[model samples]
Target chain A: MNEAITTISVAAGDSVETLFRAHYARLVRALAVVAGSQEAAADAVQEAFVKAHLHWRRIQRYDDPVGWIRRVAINKLRDDHRRGGRKERAVERLKADARPDQIEWSNGQDVTALLAELPRQQRLAMALFYVEGLPIVEVAAAMKLSEGAVKFHLHQGRDRLRGVVAISQEQLP
Target chain B: MSEFDDDRMERLLGAAGGAFPDVNTAYAQVQGRVRHIKQRRSMIAGTAACAVLVVGGAFALGSTGQRSNLQPGDHGSLSVDASVDTQSTPATDDTSAIRPSTTTAGSGAGSNGQGTSSQPTGPSSSTAATTTPSNPATADVQTYTCAGGTITVRLAAGALELVSSQPAAGFALDTSTATATRIEFRWRSSSDDQSIRIDLIGGVPVRKV
Candidate 1:
């Protein structure tokens, strides 16, 4: 890994280095929400960006290269989950490793548990709509679902989260 | 009202994704992987070019009735093509090749079918452009709902054509050239009956070509 060199060559507005810097952390965080583990999320994003770099010569030609990167990274995380129980195992590790002092713990295991409980597309809708700050229409666009479907997922995701969080709070107090 | 409708739920959902450590090392880590993949890419490209040269030479020899070295009965293309592929990835090779492993790992990825699609054992990555054998009849088919439109590429039937795009909400797969994004480009390799098919999505090569 080289030091962050100021990219001397800029073709148009999008550069590989520029995209990486701007979205690397954001992608890691967003995918952690989807994949439920910071390490795995980072791994997926790193792998995705590596592909982006591999195809950068042509990828830079796209209208939304960063969006393409995001889609690939998210799909990688999704595929990682589909491949096996790695993310679930990671979550179990999260619960066991919770120190009550860490940010994940502060955020509440219930959040992770509930997020996992949501169906895949619904979770994706939540991640894009809330975590990544994409508007509803854009979230629909990103997920390749209809705007009605996006709204549906959002509604279902919120309804599920509310019910679960309320139950968690009652048990806490 | 939905749970997320409330401010408390909003705060929690917004904070769902946790922070990562050592943010500074991230770009470096990604860059390191990029370098590794690119090196491997160049190696594949070089090996493929060499294979083409060898195959071309053998074909030139076999055409002449007196070209004794090539087996008179067996076509030169098949034998040479097999040899070329066999050299790239040994069946015993570990799954450490990250680019192919990453590109072909899941059921759905936009492109890079060019390299490391070990299942069919055809050429991959940039080498796909040059390594189309003529004898392959198998069709690799897949349907993906990308961005706005549904993109499907069915290979071997004919020319690279868009199967269907309804509402065509987003992304376009144009086979006119290699630089097309949101479009899947299918290239048929020109080695007689043995051909390689490559699918590129958003300018990234997908499963095979």
Candidate 2:
């Protein structure tokens, strides 16, 4: 996150507004890639931030407060996956039947679709590493994986994405 | 070859990220979610409070309906709460607990030794109760009960005497409103000097009282 940082008194329970201002959009975009839908990602991130606001006293003391928020959002996505299959199926069905323009297609390639071929942990590592641009330790913290595991997933994820990138380039119109 | 790969991979990843539509109302979403959480918590608190009140109210209403045990020798120990009037002497072998006294044939209207100061020496109301000869006509009188005590309202002969657990204070017939099948009266006691009216409905009293 090379975004500008405004200098102010940093304290626990404070900076929620500042943190939201800086990272809310980027968090939503990154989570949308992870969740495969803008709608679900927005909802998940909003709820996670709501939780963060409640526990801001503790959360703001963390080394990476935005990383904590991302972890919460990711956990929420996982929970929705486990609890209700109907909503997940409905979203997939909507995407399948929705109009072409209604869908957000990358001009180059769909990185999430490409990452879908990788293992879940590897895909998550890549998203946190590249899309959200978190460090290895932060990614490990967010994923609740060890730093070494994050490194391994990142290595494997990059190796897989390399193949995907070459293929998409060859298929270019 | 490197992280975020400056050439082909970077461009591909950036394109994918760029495709994500901007959500302009991020703060609005946070506010909405926070409000929703607060509302859900309050609703749960309100439901719990209502349940407690309902349970406590039911307990209070039920607690007073118990018939107190007052033996023959316990006359001096009789204590009456005007609110509950829960204190009473238990019915002896001579008095059937289930079969309440039901006398409605004749009261020569002469000897009522325990008459109230309100109608002093006119008719010994307590004596009228004792002179009630046990007869089959006892089947005609109906007993109505409330939260406080039982008031046996009977239209016997031409008069109505609402003999309560307390002999001194109870309802008397408002002769102007007495009918063959129904009886209406204006009763006034000390603590509850409010005029009482009992509308006998299907052998039970059901009203705002």
| TM-score to true structure, per model | 0.53, 0.54
DockQ of 2: 0.26
> Which digits, one per residue and each the tens of the lDDT, describe model 1 over residues B1-209?
22333455445655667764455698788788778877898999999999999999988565532221222222233343333334232221112111122111122233334334434333342234222435422222223332223333323333333332221322232332212222332222232111112354433334332
* lDDT over C-alpha atoms for residue A103 of model 2: 25
Using DockQ as the measure, which candidate wins?
A: 2
Provide the interface RMSD of candidate 1 in angstroms, 1 decimal place.
Answer: 5.6
Best TM-score among the predictions, by candidate number: 2
Which parts of model 2 have CA positions greater than 4 angstroms off? A1-10, A13-15, A54-65, A83-109, A170-173, B1-8, B19-24, B61-80, B83-209
Worst 10 residues of 1 chain A by lDDT: A1-10
TM-score of 1: 0.53
lDDT of each: 0.53, 0.51
Interface RMSD of each: 5.6, 3.6
lDDT string, candidate 2, B1-209, tens digits: 33443345445455554454454577777878788888998999999999999999988445423212121211111222231122122121111211222221122112223323432122233223323535413422333332223344443443343332322235322222333334333433444332223443433322223
Per-residue error at B33 for model 1, in Å? 1.1
Error of 2 at A110 (Å): 3.1
